[model samples]
Target: MTRTTHDTHPVQGPEDVSGEATTSRWQQVRATGDAGLATAEYAVATVAAVGFAGLLIAILKSDEVRELLLGIIRGALSVG
Candidate 1:
């Protein structure tokens, strides 16, 4: 098949016709399913952060962990 391009009108092939259908399908899929993906991701991250913070707080508040951290800090700071 020969291909020709003109300044006034571009060539339209079968691919061009199906490209619109593909684009519309993609748009519909994203519009229906991915709209709340960001919110869900944010919510998951927030929950994970809160859980990690709570775990840290619990660990820091424990006497054993506090003593261990203090010992490490004191050992690091002490002069040789």
Candidate 2:
């Protein structure tokens, strides 16, 4: 198989293509589907973060696991 210089590169650009339709950035941002989606995504993410934080606080405050880890770490760090 053989390749030519023309096949490897394109000289024409978007500006060279005339009369092609384009969408403005503000128009895309104003779409009905765009606005609500970000807020909905953010709400779900915020709820997950809060739930995870609550679970972590519960573990830190509990008696058995926290105490066990602390004792192990302290023993490993102890100097003779």
Candidate 3:
């Protein structure tokens, strides 16, 4: 008796997906080539975060807010 091999459509890899294939987050990121952020992007994000923090600190330190916060803290801590 003789044995024969079958020629099926070909094995697929992680990158080989049908048009309707559902991909995991990792596969999507890999396909997108997410090599770290560029220097300019990092710098801009850092500056924006620092500016936001500074704005919040300024708002919190203003006289009215400072008074309000201190009053709330004192009221909460007081034993009635």
Best first by TM-score, ranked:
1, 3, 2
User: Candidate 1, residues 1-80: lDDT per residue as tens digits?
Assistant: 21346433234555556777657656756665643358779999999999999999999999999999999999999999
Best by TM-score: 1
Model 2 scores a TM of: 0.49
TM-score of each: 0.55, 0.49, 0.52
What tens-digit string does per-residue lDDT give for candidate 2 at 1-80? 22233533333445544433234323433553332348779899999999999999989889897899899999999996
lDDT of 3 at 42: 99
Task: TM-score winner between 1 and 2, please give it.
Answer: 1
Better of 1 and 3 by lDDT: 1
TM-score preference between candidates 1 and 3, better one: 1
Lowest summed lDDT window (length 10), candidate 3: 1-10
Q: Residues 1-80, candidate 3, lDDT per residue (tens digit)? A: 21223232223456656554434534655665745789999999999999999999999989999999999999999999
Best by lDDT: 1
> Is 2 or 3 the stronger prediction by TM-score?
3
